[model samples]
Target: MGVAGSGKTTVAALLAGRLGAEFAEGDEFHPPENVAKMSDGMPLEDSDRWPWLGHIRDWLAEQAAAGRSAVVPCSALKRSYRDLLREAGPVRFAHLTGSRELLTERIQGRAGHFMKPAMLDSQLATLEPLGDDEDGFTVDVFPRPPEIVDEIIAHLDR
Candidate 1:
């Protein structure tokens, strides 16, 4: 859970595979309108995001009901959004953090993605880092994805 270019999806996918947990790309949960909005370089407002967040939460609930562990990577930029996700069940966030320059470079390097590098500032501005009370830990994005996953797994084991 971090900004647009924080490697959330890549790391979460690898983490899910490592844990043998169900995997969902949170971006896939966004409605077409949301996609269109982002594609048009507009940052989504809270109202536009609530339903999308609900869908992700509901999917997690379904996985839990089926007795499966799941990993989903979401921007979840605000504490309120994370709180809402927790309503689904016990959720631990692995925040992929890095310097602004690194994040911008990563986003700029990407292609065919709805999220534009130009929008990274909006996401960064919106991001609320995990509080001490939150059930989560931060992992720097400087390490490779496998190393990031290892750190997360170790943190969970502890």
Candidate 2:
């Protein structure tokens, strides 16, 4: 996971296809009100996120219980959020990172997404890069989606 417009959804979707895993979008876990707020270009408070994060975690737990692998795209911007998700199951995050200019360009070019371009800065501010102890690695967003997925697979195999 990374900031807005970091290609998390694109990468996660392609990765899931390659890995033959179920795919979920973290944005879909957000409550309607949260989506409305974001649609209005407002950043959500922490109180608004806990439930959404919980939903994502629950999905992960369900997938594990079914003995299936899944890929989820989420802006797990904080270490605490990552920790919360890990409690549901064994999860390895693939953080998609990019330059601010590139990220903004991506957001600007997008359409029909609830998250507004204005929220990018707040996301960036809240973002905490993967830590040394976290079970994941960061990937630069410069490469094409397939290339990014290839890198993730390569790293996972290592």
Kindly give the number of clashing pairs for every candidate. Answer: 0, 0
User: Residue 81, candidate 1: how far off, in angstroms?
Assistant: 0.2
The collision pairs in model 1 are none
- lDDT string for model 2 (2-56, tens) is 8899999999999999999999988999999999999999998889989999999
Q: Give the residue spans of candidate 2 off by over 4 A.
A: none
Assess candidate 1 and give its lDDT.
0.94
For all predicted structures, in order, the TM-scores are 0.98, 0.98
Cα lDDT of all candidates, in order? Answer: 0.94, 0.92
Over 13-69, each residue of candidate 1 has an lDDT whose tens digit, in order, gives: 999999999999999999999999999999999999999999999999999989999
List candidate 1 stretches off by more than 4 Å: none
lDDT computed for candidate 2: 0.92
Indicate the TM-score of model 2.
Answer: 0.98
- Clashing pairs in model 2, backbone N/Cα/C closer than 3 A: none
Scored against the true structure, residue 43 in model 1 reaches a CA lDDT of 94
Query: Given candidate 2, what's the lDDT at residue 142?
Result: 95
